[model samples]
Target: MERPFSVFHYGGTTSYDAHGGRRSRDIPAGEAGSGLGGGGLHRLHHHTDHDGRPAPHREAHSESGHGWERLVFSNALQAVSIVSVVQCGVGLSNADVVPKYGFGPIIKFLKVLVVQQILWAVSLSLCKIAILLLYSKIFATRAMVMAARIMAGFTAVWTVITVLIAFFICRPLSDNWLLDLKNRNCGNQPAADGTMGVLNMITDIAVLVMPISYLWKLRLETYKKVALIVTFSLGVL
Candidate 1:
C-alpha cells in the first residue's frame, strides 16, 4: 500500500502515490499560487478519504478570498488617492499659471481648492472607515464591532457635512472663487476651515484610541501588546 499526497501547482493540483505515480484526477487550477513559472512550495499536505483514497482540496488565495467590503473600500481609497494626486499636480501648476495667466487662473485655482478640500475629507473618511472595518473583522468582539460600526458611521457623516460646508460655504457658490464679487455673503471661511481641521484631528485621535483597550486585553505579552498598540497608533502620525 502506498501513501498518497497532493501537490499544489500554479495551474492545478496533482496527487502522487509513494512510487511517484500520479493517482488522482488533476484538479482544476485554483488561485492559490503565484504566477511565476518556476514553482516553489506553496503548501504541502496529505489526507485520505474514509475509504482510503487520497483527498484533494482546493485552496483559495488571500486575494481571491477577501470580502467584498475590503475590495470596495480599498478600491475607493485608491481611486480617491489618484484623484488627490492629480489635484496636487494641478495646484503645483497654478504657481506658474498665476505668474503668467494672472487673476483669470486664480478663480480656477480657488475652485480646485474647494474640490481638493472635499476630496481630502472623503479620502480621510474612507481610510478611517476601512481601518474600522478591519478592526471589526480582526477583533470580532461585540464591543469592538459596535465601536467600529459607530465610528464608521460618524466618520461618514462627518465627511458628508464637511463636503457640504466646503461646497456651500459661500452663498451663490461662485463667491468661493470670486474673491472680489460684490455683495457676496459668505460665512467666516477661515474659521470654518479651522474648525473642520480640529474636528478631523479629534476623529484621528479617537480612532487611534479605540483599539488600544481591546489590544491590551489580548492574551499577548505586555511588550507585544504595547508594540501592537504603537504600530496601530502610527496611523495618527
Candidate 2:
C-alpha cells in the first residue's frame, strides 16, 4: 500500500512582550489582515517530512535560508496593509475609493488605489508560488508533482501579464492616475479588468480542485476522504 504523504514544516518566529498582551505583536497586523499571518503562528523549530525533503523555507540553502519566503511575503503584505490603512484613514473606503472633489483629490485617490492593487497582485503571486512549493513537498506522485509545477509556471506567467497590464493600461503610466487627458487615448480598462478577474477566479478554482482526484483515489476510509476534500476545498476561499 502507498504510504500517507506528510506536510512540510518550517521555523517561524513570533515576538511578544513579557506581559503576553497585544497578540497582534505575535502576528503582524498587516499580515493578519492579508491572510499571510499563518506563517508566524508556525513554531520556530524544524521538523523534516517523511520523504526527507527539508522544509524549503527553513533549510540552509540560500542566503537568507530560514523563513525567507514567509518573511518576504509577510513583509510585503504588511507594507501594503499599512499604506491601505493610511489611505482609508484619509477618507477612502469601500463605500467610495474615488472622491468627487478637485483634480488633486481624485488623482491622489486613484494613485492609492493603483498602489493597493499592485501590492495585492504581488502578494497573491508570492502566496501561489509558496502553495505550489508546499504541495510539491507533500505530494510525491509524479502526476501530482508535475501538476504543481505547471500551476506554478502558469502563476508566474499570470503575475507578469497582470503586472504589465496594470502598469501599461495607459500610456506614460502616470496617465493611469491623471484626472484629465485631452489628446491621449486609453483602452477599455473595465473590460480588461473584468477579463482578468474572471481568469483569476477560474485559476483559483482549478488550484482548489486539482488534488481531489488523488485524494479520493487513496486507499483510505470514506470519512477520511470526505474530510480531506472538505479541508482542501477551503483553499478556494
Candidate 3:
C-alpha cells in the first residue's frame, strides 16, 4: 500500500509524508524533511495517517520547550496593548477632556497620560522582544541567536529608560500633572520626545531587517523569498 501524505496551508503550502517529514514546494528537494520550516506555529500542523486522520510524530517535539515562552510573551503583549487602549479611551484624551472641563479634569487627564506613556513604552518593547524571541527560535543560527539576544536586551533597557524618563521628566513628580505649580523644573519635553521617537524608529528598522539576510540565504525560489520577506516586513505596519 502507498504511504499517506498530508498537505497543510500555512503562509505557504507544505506537504508532509507518513513519517511526519515536511516537503515544501518552495524548498528544494534536498532540504525537504531536514527540519520544520516557519515559526513555532508551524509545528501545530501534523501529518495524517492512511485514514486521513491527524497523526502525531517526533517533529511535534521540535523546539517544544520554547512554546510556553512564546505564548507568555505574546499574551503579555496583547494584554498590555488592550489595557493601554482602554486607558486611553477612558481618561487619556487631552483634546476631549481638556476643553470640556477645568484644571481638575486636565490634571486627571495628565495623570492618566503619564501612565499611558509608560504603558506605551512597555507595550512597544514587549512587541519587539517577542519578535526577537520568535527570530531566535525560527532562525536558530549562532549569529542570529546572538543578535536576537542582544536586541532583546537593548529593548528591555530602552523600555526601562523610557519609563524612567516619563516618571522623572519633571522634578517633584507632582509637577508633571500640576500645571500651575510654582518652581517646577522640567526637562526639554519636545526634544526628549523627538529623540526617543527617532531612536524607536531606529530600533524598529533594525528588527525589521534582522531576518532578511538569513532568509535570502535559504534555498527558496525568488518569488517565495520575496513573499516571505514581505510577510515578515508586515511588522513595520
User: Which runs in model 2 stand beyond 4 Å of their true positions?
Assistant: 1-78, 88-103, 181-184
lDDT of 2: 0.59
Per-candidate count of clashing residue pairs (backbone under 3 Å): 0, 0, 0
Q: Candidate 3's residue-wise lDDT over 59-136, tens digit each?
A: 466646644644565566566556545543453566775566545655555676676677678767877887898887
Question: Model 1: per-residue lDDT, tens digit, 107-196?
Answer: 655676776677677767877887887777555457778999999998888889899998788987888887675677788888988888
How far off is residue 108 in model 1, in Å?
Answer: 1.8
Q: Each candidate's lDDT (Cα)? A: 0.66, 0.59, 0.68
> Which parts of model 3 have CA positions greater than 4 angstroms off?
1-100
List TM-score per model, in order: 0.59, 0.63, 0.63
Clashing pairs for model 2 are none
Q: What is the lDDT of residue 223 in candidate 3?
A: 80
Clashes of 1: 0
Model number with the top lDDT: 3
36-73: candidate 2 lDDT, tens digit per residue:
23331122323445654334364544435445665675
Which run of 10 residues does model 2 get worst, by summed lDDT?
4-13
